[model samples]
Target chain A: MSFLKYRLRMDKNVHLIMKILTVFSIVTILAILLGLLYKAYPILKTHSLTNLLLSKDWFPQKELFGLFPFISSTFQVTGLAMFIAVPFCLLASIYLSEYASKSITRLVLPLIDILAGIPSVIFGIWGIILIVPFIRDYVAPFFGKVSSGYSILTGGIVLAVMLIPVMVNILLEVFNTVSRGYKEASLALGATKWQCIKHVLLIKSAPGIISAIALSLSRAFGETLAVLMVVGNVTKSPKSILDPAQPLPALIANNYGEMMSVDLYDSALLLASLVLFIIVLFFNIIARVILRRLEKNNH
Target chain B: MKFKAKFIEERIFKILMITSTSIILLSLGAILGSILYKGLPSLSWEMISQTPKGGFYLGKSGGILNAILGSFYIAFGATAIALLVSLPVALYINIYRKKFSKYSNLVRLCLDVLWGVPSIVYGALGFSVMLYIGLKTSLLAGIIIVGILIIPVMIRAMDEVIKTIPKGLVEASLALGSTKTETAFKIVVKQALPGIITAILLSFGRAIGDAASVMYTTGFTDNIPKSLLSQAATLPLAIMNLVSSPIVEVQNKAYASALILTFIILFLSIISRLLSIKYTKNKSH
Candidate 1:
């Protein structure tokens, strides 16, 4: 204890240096926010809030920059992706923990790692080559409709595929956190294995599972290329799942290449980045809260 | 009858679980299978040994050496920079164990939020900063953005591994008059060496595969970046540009790049996993 006090008050140069460096994480966050907001401020100052956010008009030459369609489309694709990924992953995790033996888990875990490691661009190309062709040639024609197979549905499906590994891995860990004794006790009380899972496992893992979903939801929302390639980035908000639409990440990405040519275009795209930043941060905050609660419970 | 119904229900749920797991496996197979099948044939000595020729992207004959080298330079550079900041931060978080104090909680939350920030947003943010400073698309810009991307990942991974070190070992070292830095670097980090290696390579995998952040900041060039100021092409961006080409020849090159990309990722993932597995086994005993 005296040795610790000696280091604490001795002005230990190395410790002091590290204490300063620990602040870099916070500094990095502030720097990114400041950079984004500094560029976005020009556009925000010029445009009214309602006009910038709620109106669907995206004509850039007239300085019109309403992002209603893009924002809505962003949420729609993310929501649909989450809807598919969450339930599917929950079932997969339950199976992994409750039923599958260690050998089966050994075989499957590496594949999940492979899935996680595939580049998003590869996923985009896969969507283009595989999913888009199927939807265009078969699925879209089922309702007597003409389509290019680039739609919110295509984006959602591709995103759901991308999110599966992330959701399953986190939720599997959450499911693992439920102590073994609880399940044993439930079985001792004459409950079926299924009842044990439903009552003890699901109830116990709920916070962790929800937080994982929130994290995955944020990832889906922020994804760019896979959605961009398949979504047929039209500027109008999608009226149906099959309609192509633009989201904020896609809009900025598609335009940023050509942004140097247009006046105020860089600022406009930066504003969209800010919006994406805020939305992802919002979901992350919710997830952090849930995880902290879980941590406290564990202690 | 009650036992029969319960048995059937369990069987059905198990079927659904295995089926879902199969879909994930199938997706991996199909993606890699298609990329390798289409790409392996086109991966040639000429293709990998030289830069792109005239009309190379339009299905003409050329190589992706520019991108391959560019990727190495950028990923290694980014990871190197991220390590400088991340190690100290990870050690700090570990050495000062606040457990779940508000300040520590806030720090973890910030890192998570940074980790979740989409790479494209990082690109956009970098682009704006470039505009302010008037820096062109170059290796430096790419490194900065990709460095930001790798920092949080590296920190979290290292911190998790460091947190697993026995606290009593650290306290004992301190009681014996070893300095805080000496205990951390000499004892704790040495014990966590396997984990630190995995963290480094895992972040390396992530950095090399990312295209969106580098697409704008690192302008595509057929030549390897000669300096920090020079723009460079990466395999991901090369694949993206080539795949949509109307030429069947260019499309084949895209697959070839995908093959190499996948190979690099596979190698990193395998090694990192092995290291962690070894570390875990060592710890458990």
Candidate 2:
């Protein structure tokens, strides 16, 4: 009886410890958000948010830190990547989910995993060696333009490749979740396979598709190393795909080492990262909510 | 006429889908092919064994031994730390809380948000924390930051594995007069061990390959780090620095470094895949 009591006491203590550790997970998130905000507050205090966000001048030596160009470049590259990647991923996922046999999917899925696992820096290297030159000499000339190759187009191409595996995986899962009965019902009406997929599977999985895009957009936005290597780190706002541009993540990655020495530089960079953090957090929250709703509806 | 148009549309869309799928597969092949084609020629045993000599980026003859070891040290340290923190949290949710409970859902939500937070943001956060604590860039700092970055990944992966254990297994263990803690450690963990190992290796691959978070927290160094406080170089940063060199030989060296990293990640992925398939046989069906 005494031994039983001792074992119960030990179990209670262990349970309490586990409870505290679990609460620490919540604390970690708060710490990341609050810590970033605390460090970024000084810059937010000194400059009006609009000026910091809207102005093009970014002479950090003179304490001028406009972020307009970076923001524009980020959106242009990410938007271009999404434009290229989404339709391709949608088509590929449809092929994999609806049309392909099991063996073909088995071969393709592992390939996607390998693609997803390739380091971002290697992707950057590949961009430099292949995509940049391909753009400069081939695609750009075909478009009646000349580019040095380290341009938004190069970055977008590399980023699009990086986004492919992620988007395909999500889309495949989403497409697979459409019930077989619905597909059969559509087919029973003498519809072609394509028609059944277009009218039934696509309509059923629209929310999942939207969430996948949102998730990958957040990923492309926060992507640094590959975009940094390919996109010429020019501070000017890019007016065309051929023009070199600097995005926010690249700005932070490139200037961080020197940021500590410059007055308000560290804060400015911190603010830039805080911007990235908040936007990504917002996207993730929306995606999560939509995905949760999709899961609920499926149930 | 309507039937003809419908038939044509089906043919067209099917052709488009096939083309897109082929494009994706071809791009994957191209990426792998280019890396191997460029990287293989420059790779050498000496390149893997020797530290970078003076003027290493200036076409000097040297190897990336320092970076290779530093990457291992940081990845191992970070993975160890993450596993300790994540295991308890994963266990707590599955064992202590009710399934699909509000509190557990909230914790899961927090982890999802954390996972979405970018690596650069984590780098900035780590840099700020270092400033607050008056610490310099070092292996310890890198490990700490990467550990934080991967906690969500490890926890979420482990959580899924733990959740997969049949409810009957836990009930049976408890019916045998064992406490909840005993069932958690002895029964549930035993079944989840294979998946837990896979999660560790996957996160290890992530931590090692990551450059953004460690670029600030772990300052680059020439020689291998002599201590945890010493600045440590990483393979990705080494590749990044090398690729910018004007020397053709040095640029080739960058490719070789990337090849090494690729191999390491590939090896880890395969090992984890095999381990999961091999050891998952005993799981409750």
* The candidate that achieves the highest lDDT relative to the unseen native structure: 2
In the range A1-299, model 1's lDDT, one tens digit per residue, is 89778665653776677778778777887888888888888888888767888998998888888889999999999998988877788888898889889999999988898799878888887787778888889988997777789988889989999999989888887887788899999999988788788899999988898899889988988999879878999999788888899888999888898877777778888989988988888888898788777767766
Could you tell me every candidate's TM-score relative to the true structure? 0.95, 0.97
Question: Candidate 2 at residue B202, lDDT?
Answer: 84
Q: Write the per-residue lDDT of candidate 2 for residues A1-299, one digit (tens) a residue.
A: 99999989988998988888778877887888888788889888999999999999999999999999999999999999999999999999999999989999988888898888888998999898899889999988999998999999999999999999989998998887888999999999999999999999999999999999999999999999999999999999898999999999999999998876788899899889988888888888898888877866776
Please give the RMSD to the true structure for each candidate, in Å: 2.6, 1.6
Evaluated on CA atoms against the true complex, candidate 2 attains a DockQ of 0.74
Off by over 4 Å in 2: B1-3, B279-285
lDDT per residue for candidate 1 within B1-285, as digits (tens), equals: 356776777778779988887777887888888777878999998888989999897777789999989988899999999998888788877775454567766777788888999999999888877877999999999998899898999998898888888889999988997777788888889999999999999899889999889989999999888999999999888888888787888888888888888889999999888898898899889
Model 1's CAPRI class? medium
